[model samples]
Target chain A: MKLETRRVTKRYGDFLALDGASFQTGKDARVVALLGPSGGGKSTLLRVLGGLLLPESGEVVVNDQPLPQEPNEALKTLRKNGFVFQGYNLFPHLSALQNIVLPLCVVHGFSEPEAKERALELLKRLGLEEHFHKRPAELSGGQQQRAAIARALAPKPDLLLLDEPTSALDPVMTGEVLDVIRELAEGGQQIVLATHEISFARKVADWVVFLAKGRVEESCAAEQFFEQPNSALAREYLDGLSRYR
Target chain B: MNHPPTRRLLWSFALMAAVSLGLYITFAAVHYSWNWSSVWGYRSQFIWGWFTTLGISLGAMVVSIMVGFALMIGRRSTCMPLHLLSTGIVEVLRGSPLLVQLLLGYYIVATALHVGDPLVVGTVLLGCFEGAYLAEIFRGAVESIGASQREAARAVGFDTAQTYRYVIIPQAVRRALPGTTGQMVSLIKDSSLLSVIGIEELVQKVRIMNSSSYTALEGYLPLAVAYLVVTIPLSWYARKLERRFAYET
Candidate 1:
């Protein structure tokens, strides 16, 4: 599968969140990290790719079909994309198992038993089999992040979108979650993540896109970008981010 | 589990009883009848009237829920006019008194529309008035569910209708139950005001009995008991509903 954008732009009342931004992804992919400062439209770009927001101009084509003009149709295309939100937005009322099963049940028309069976498989793989009956409040930060990943993976989506998936976890917990993500990428899932984890991106990403002022300042192979970035903005971002590490 | 406050509670209860007896004696000396037999004789009419009141209130509540649902959807619709129109209608109903609305629906609307049925007029008044309050409850409930749930439903390929019916609405209804029940009880009490338009509800029946027998205390006291009979069970059921669909937050 291939996902690409052509001059995709989104503006929110005088604020240009994304300005003619473009990128592409193909199957059998490694991780792609969108590195940017806050309010630089990284989240906005993720939303555009996930079909959650419509561009004021330009277009997005997923697997070669231009996204439909109608909001509902575009949203249908979004079903194939998986998103992991920052803060791990798990349903508070639902048990861990219920949270994981929801996307599958909604998308695939899976029966209750069948959905649970699939949820249990993902839970077991994520080392959360024991936490299945617990609510999100009962889980630790690491556990909630894992559950969020389990939910994102449950539908077997073609494109995975993650927004700061490990922000809440400690270093040890972050490493644990990243390992699960790396394994998914190795298994051939195309993943796009917006994160502040520069070192993790250096280790796992194949493509690195540095964004500044709602436009792509630099896009390069991860090794090349980190080793010798072409843009002055990319250099400044790397230097500023390195201090926190 | 501790019964240590028993003495204090009893003293309060005794004090309340004395105040009540003093008031009753003062009123009785002013020729309020102690006519127990009159209450017993007209008991069936009172019972029938009480049932009519329940019927009207429940009918109005059902209608209110339907109108409320429509207004809820309208408020969320894409058309700006529909949204504004419903919002204005809700405001008009909520801002005005139910008694005033009852009179208008019965007198002005009924006359202008040339409808003779008091029942129709009363029901329309009760439903439209109560529906405004309920619309806010329903809207608040729908909004209370997290935005992520709607996004999740959409991402899973459910259409807008399915998103509401299968995912958003059930969760919203669960959250909205307590407020909905409270609105319903308020509707029941407000049904009494319809008696002003000669609707022959429980309060109306008590007024007629008191006028005929001149046993104001015996007649109206039983009506208070009757209203309590309906409201108490309803209040209890509302509490049970709150517990059953408890939101921890």
Candidate 2:
């Protein structure tokens, strides 16, 4: 549960996407909410953590082992990490159950019977038992989000990375999906979410990392960060977030 | 024998047929002498020649298709040297005409290397020539698949090779099927050029028959019929392939 980044940086051609951003989270700090608006490097940071993108210069260490840049090595470590993208990038060709079960079968080499049983159990827990056989196209947006979460949880990874997990949902749908995330946190899972819902952050997050313009604006305990943020930007942002709500 | 309008239509058709036959007879009798006996005799030879050409084209098409798929995958591979090599090969083959490739295969490779078997040499040449064109078709189709699919595969822990194998190639092959079929028809037509390499295809056989029989029109007309007989089925099969690969698109 020791996740640390030492001056992680990324540049796409000439554009500096992330510049000297760094953070640390120990086992005690379970939920780290990366709160930022779009294009503020939150997704970039999530990608670097998932090892999907190799930063131009940085060190990402999980449980004391350095993450490698090679795709195979990164994939080996990434299998132990679950990422929920904003678009819920599920394989369209696979059924909901298959999408969930694929990680266990392919990465862990689980037998068909065991994989199917585990997949069904996760789907049932996610309240998607009836849509197991349906493809992503056949499901509603909320159901697709649930299936994406189910997939993320299939391998029972040590880290769960969510990028705007509930941003695309309606209020009612958002509540239904956030409840599942709440249950996951309650069940002692390590969750890191990049979310816009300040109230949800207040309720569920153990720590908040506010980022602005590719740098960390503030990092503090959830209550302290919400109540009296150190950075003026975070204070103004919270005020604006409340006003918009 | 029938009602007025029906009988009139039938009489008209019969009259047209009679006039057409009379015209054909008059033209042939005046210019080209009747040769029913020779036509009856060389029926087996014509059948044999047509089958030989069909068989050769079929073989060439299969070899070229396999080569084309390999080129497509090879060119798209992350290895830079392989990609460059495949690109060079495709450029060289496609830049030259198929007839030149056939002749080169017959003279340069076959004689210089002492391969000696023209039939094998001819088919290989046809395959190599057609493969270059098909490679472009396949590469374009494979690259056209959305980048999201590749990202999803990587997220699920599939290696690059596995992503191409499971996700990219299946979709690309389906997308490229129509282009491939068109290439196949062109390849079959291009196989006709192999006659220049002393391969006794239908056209070449017709040349031989014309030389011996001194009936250029008579000998070549049936050869044209033979070519049509082979091509008609192939065009039908191409249509069938388009329908078959239209599933997911």
Candidate 3:
């Protein structure tokens, strides 16, 4: 997946969330991680990439095509991408299997049997087959997040955009979710994620984009960016993250 | 919270005993002697009236829910005229007295429109009165759903109607159950007001018996019990529905 943003600017009242943010994924980078501190515009940029949020101004180009301004026309782009939110945001009323099947059958117009087969496949792949009939309230944080990921993946979207997918989990559960993401990355799935899991990003991310104060500070291959961050802001950001470790 | 069945039964017996004692004391305190002979003559009337009340209440309940849903949709519509019109009508129905609406509907509007059946007009007017309140309840339930739910639906490519039908409404209906149950009980009791428009319901039958028997208490007591008979079962059904819709927690 070729993901690119050009001069994207977004504001929420007085807070500038994304200010002229621009970056392009390497043609072969299967997993691109947006690395930044809290409220550093990483999530906003990821949302724009996922077609979940439209920037107030500027272009979000994915695979060399910019998203249309009007929402109706942009549905094509939105449909091609799947998003996993920070909170996991699974429908509380639906079972784990249903969480995946409903959108496939309802929105994408898949037959029930076909959607069910697809949902069951993903659940088994995510190691959630036993929890197929359980509602979100009955599942652990990691299980719920995995179910949400399955829901996003069921439609076979070209790009998967995840926003802090493990933010609500414990260290143990975070590892559980991260392992699944790593597997997806290794399987050649295209993913753009905004995440705080620094070491995990270093391990799985093919490309890295460092953001701070609502602007991109650096963008490069993951290993180089993690080992020798060029920008002073990027260096300090990495230094601050390493303090606790 | 986990009382043993024997203990629960004991508590139930105690409550019944208490209520029975209160009733006994009240009857003893009254000056007039009890006379079942006169009231017994109207057994068939009571039976007829009881069933009539049930039919009217069920009819009105259906109307109220349909009208309420339509109004809720209208109020939530993006079209300016529809939103304003639904808002204005909801306000009017909620603000004014039900008796006034029934009178106007039966005496004026129904007459002018050649809607001669007072029963139909009364049921509709009474339903509209409750429908306004129900519309607000439905709206509140839909609004109480977290924004994230809508976002989740949208992220999966749901359009406006599909979102409501597949995601929003199923959850909203669960949240709205308790409020709707209360409204239904109120609707059953409120159906007695339909007697004013010559519906010949339970309350109307009781009024007729009281006019001759001159025993208001005797006439009204049975009416109250009949209403309770309808509502107790209704409340039980609501609880069952609540359990069915409740998310596992």
User: Which prediction has the highest DockQ against the true structure?
Assistant: 3
lDDT of 2 by residue, B1-249 (tens): 436998899988999999989979888787867565665566677777788788888888888988888898779878999999999999999998877877877888789988998888988888888988998998999899888678767766778777777667766777788788788878777777888888888777777776676666778767766777767787788777666644322
Q: How close is candidate 3 to the true structure, as a TM-score?
A: 0.96
RMSD (CA, angstroms), candidate 2? 6.4
In terms of TM-score, the best-performing candidate is: 3
Residue-level lDDT tens digits of model 3 in B103-163:
8889999999999987788878878999999999999999988889999888988877888
Candidate 2 runs further than 4 Å off: A167-176, B1-40, B206-249
Candidates 1 and 3 compared by lDDT, better number:
3
> What stretches of model 1 exceed 4 Å from their correct place?
A1-3, A24-28, A62-65, B1-33, B107-117
Q: Where does candidate 2 chain A have its weakest 10-residue lDDT segment?
A: A85-94
- For every prediction, compared with the true complex, DockQ reads 0.44, 0.30, 0.71
Going through the candidates in the order shown, the clash numbers are 0, 0, 0
Candidate 2 docks at the CAPRI level of: acceptable
Task: Tell me the lDDT of candidate 1.
Answer: 0.83
Error of 2 at A176 (Å): 4.5
Per-model fnat list: 0.35, 0.35, 0.75
lDDT of 1 by residue, A54-162 (tens): 8999888776878886876787777777888877777666788988786677667888899999999999999999999998888888888889889888888878888
